[model samples]
Target: MVATGWRPKAGNRMPSPSRLAGLLRDGRFVVTAELSAANSADPEATWRRAEVLRGSVDAINCTDNTGAHVHISSLAAAHLLVEKGLEPIMQLTVRDRNRLALQADLLGAAALGVRNIVLMSGDDVTAGDHPEARRIYDIDSMQLVEVAAGLRDRGTYLSGRKLEQAPSFFIGAVENPFAPPLEFRPLRLQKKVRAGADFIQTQLVFDVPIFARFMAMVGELGLLDKVFIIPSIGIPRSARGARYMKEKVPGLHVPDSLVDRLEKTAAARQADEGVRIAVELVSAVREIPGVAGVHLIGIKWEEGVVQVAEAAGLLPRPTFSPRASVGGHG
Candidate 1:
């Protein structure tokens, strides 16, 4: 179940799910892995990541310097990915960007045939490599949803110019199903819905029954049909990786049993075990009612994500490699 609560803003427009709902019906889960471009300016590495995902997943989600990890700009990656024939979902991070930059990126994504996007306030700048880097939160995630939707429907850019054709995108927002105060999860999601989010991709969800309960509460609010809920599953690799996630990432929790298993296993085999667990998680969630699909967060273990999707039967065997599509000047 999903919740709704978005309000119209400047150039007010009615909310609709025409874009994202179609992707959900397509039946392929959107696998979101961090693009490892060592340098944000290099578009080649970003293209390679998108190419690999194109072979294994239906859509590629690019993060805006996710957690300050190494990568290209989320918008750049999304643009390249769309050009490479894969669906692109740009992560619209409001933090560290001005209103103009946000507007440009949104228009850029739309121009490139990226029909969906995910809005996020973003992780603290301290979480990134350059701890001293400054941030510019000109608008929060909810405000972003309102602004993007408003502009898209009005057939004009934020600058008030007419478009050859108004760009349309299926907008989404993040949700944490395992919040400390579970009661607030529904209300919070409701706010995003009212803010014009067409879909929701939840934070790392491990406990299935708890997630189901959260879905039930969302249903009680009578917004399920109006919104699509896609839960994200993070597949852990090394002990260092698991530890760093649990201790460093906000709004993320790693279960003890899985951590114990990772600790007991050999370092070289940890990624394999982690992928197996992720496959199990996805398989279980597929049976739950009202679930749209799983969004896999592979971190740096991209190939392991392919294995997890294969194990979950989300990808077909003997997949074609998109090698020719990468390495060209982006």
Candidate 2:
């Protein structure tokens, strides 16, 4: 795959808002995967990832500088996916943009026919190569969710300015159930739902009990019906990769037993063992009471999503019929 750079499409608009929204509303177990680290050297980068995920995942997540490293912008990648006849869950992070820039991108996404936006606070600039870079968190994730909701639900900006056409956004927010003060995580999610998060995506979860407990609390708080929950599972390429996530990635945990299991396997077989473990984790999470679906992150190995989705029996993703174009940019 080659790297690429881009802006929004000139006049590409979809007939419907978001296919993921329709699937969640219909109670389908949606599958999604990250389009990993798209760079600027190749224009075909985004589609290459999407091609592997096509028909295997319900939607692809165009990440916004995840790990705080530079790449093709998430909005641009989302636009590429849309142009490819694929659905993208575009991510928006406040680490490098003020509210104005953030809101502008929200409008830009709507104009491109990209309907879903997941709000995030983002990783620290230190986590990336440019350690000295500054951050501009004009609004946190929850506040950003509120901001997107205003544009969609109220057709106005945070300044109360009106829009001729309101954006149709299926807003989403992230949570890490494995983080400390675990009990408070549910209460935190409660706040996001109140702020207008239509759906929830979580950080990588290796411990099923932790995720199960988190969902149980959400269910007990009456949050099950308010927001759809899609848990993320990160597939390590090897035992070394698994160890890195446990030791380096903040707010994520990799159990010793899992790592040891991978280590016991032959060197070349470790990758397959990791994938086997991921498939098992997917199966386990599927049995959780409130789960709407799963989001798999395979780093650079995009095909793993297809393999896990099929092994976990989430293949044959459903299709949608977008309504007649609102004709904004047909």
Candidate 3:
């Protein structure tokens, strides 16, 4: 299938303003993806994965040692992705870094043409390749968001040091609505927003009713007007893939109906059926009030994600045109 994707022209040392911010502020439906992990020495491996998502997503997220697994630095991956002509939502997790490292990297990202950043409290080291690695909790995600906001808005550091030029950042935070204590999820989102989050990307969504209720509470709390909400949906490649998400992934509610549909299909056709279900899920996510967009994450079958985007009529995605200023949601 032909992948129709748009990329910000790469060449100038000067970084452009954030297209992701502009699109969301203009009331446009944004499409983003958590790019498949890349670990090769060169940028080709990452670029190829991004190529599949380009047509469907407006911005691609580079994970930060996801699941505590080690890979190339998220910053390096993001810089390479920028060079490859793709926008990178560079994720900064507090799991491995202290406040000093976080602040420096945040500034470094701005200098390297990365305008979108997401703050996350990542998984423990035991979850990945290095169980003995030390954990740093000098600050949490909310504090990190505050620090980023200070740099973006006031041009000062947590130490009160001043900068000649502040980095323009479109800050983001992640939330898990599918998890139990659902009511507290929106409340935490409110705190994140107050801490200077411009947008919220929810955990993988499978149960629509639960998400709808979460959105309703978000609306009731009057947070709908404060931050953009983008729900994530993983494209399962087969019945087995769907079952894995339900059984293996924590805090996710994958209904039996979805898994059953894919399971009953022939093995050869299950892949195609997976795409169909994903497209339908995207459509369902769009109808809910206060949903700014949908983020599609491809597990191992990145190609299947491309098909879902095309099948859902998500091609010719919103152009990545930089505005003069990265607008603050605050």
Candidate 4:
């Protein structure tokens, strides 16, 4: 119903695996929904929303300047979530920011006890609708993940200096299940893992069957055990949302049927249609074997995300009391 949930109970083991992907490894679903608001200042509002949703979901997924349309950095927003006591999987955009800034952000996150991160190459700066914006790419997304993983693993900074304490982040990367020739996605995913990626989240997934096939291939790679893979799905609200994603966001494609649905829905029913589509897609996502959970991207539909979660049967949920469960196992 609300964006932020209740403060997580103390000493609950913070959920084992710590990373978004690892959280989903045990066959439990993990949802990484986006709730970052347009304004970057004061994440408390969205962070609170994240807390509320975290109860029903495994992890909260934040985006980094998603599609470069408008919004605060995903890392900033995720830090806000962290401050609010939610486990946030922040997206690291490896486009404009350099390695130094990225490393700093990582340290800041670790200092705040924020674990779990998602690395992305990010959309082109020119794509931001701000033609005057400059793009600074020191490294690609995969390279960024590799660097972060090495630092987190080796207790050293990129400069090769040992740190007082190495960060323990659950590093994640992205993939597009709908990438052309789809055959190449597995190889790309493998490269990321070999480079030290612990888990992965994929691009917008519209077709469950296509995603199932992607999972089957993932199983073949033995990655299911070593790395966690979850797919992303967006809640299309306006014709503008769909249009922007289709025409601007690289590596993201909205199926025609959904577009057609949006086209046909009356203005008054558009919101309901969006919720129904998200619920149906999310419900289907949870059923995918090895799927950690669904990442709901409802940038403007913050409240709508709650409705979708409820409709998807992911809410009215129990607190994730790892201690109680661990004792039960014992």
- All candidates: TM-score: 0.84, 0.92, 0.91, 0.84
Name the candidate, 2 or 4, with the larger lDDT value. Answer: 2
Each candidate's number of clashing pairs is 7, 7, 0, 8
Off by over 4 Å in 4: 1-22, 43-54, 321-330
Candidate 1 residue-wise lDDT, 259-298, digit = tens: 8878899998988888988988988777665576778888
Higher TM-score: candidate 1 or 4? 4
Q: Rate the local accuracy (lDDT) of all candidates.
A: 0.70, 0.81, 0.82, 0.69
Rank order by lDDT, top first? 3, 2, 1, 4
RMSD of each: 7.0, 7.3, 5.2, 6.0
Show the colliding residue pairs in model 3.
none
Give the alpha carbon lDDT tens digit for every residue of 34-152 in model 2: 88868865758778878998999878899999999998999999989899888888999999999999999999998998987889999999999999999999888889998987887
Worst 10 residues of 4 by lDDT: 3-12
Compared with the true structure, what per-residue lDDT tens digits does model 4 show for residues 1-330? 121111111221222236443334334455667665545466566665666565656667777776666677776777777676677787888777898998888888778766778888888767766657778788788888878866776778878889887777667788898888887788889899777776677888877888889888876876665566667777888766776777766777677788778888887888788888888887777666666567777766667777787888776543442321210111
Candidate 1 regions with alpha-carbon error over 4 angstroms: 1-21, 26-34, 37-42, 156-164, 317-330
Q: By summed lDDT, which 10 consecutive residues of candidate 2 come out lowest?
A: 1-10
User: Which lDDT tens digits does candidate 3 get at residues 86-187?
Assistant: 889999999999989999999999999998899999888887889999999899999999999888888899899998888888889999997778889889
Pick by TM-score: 1 or 2, better one: 2
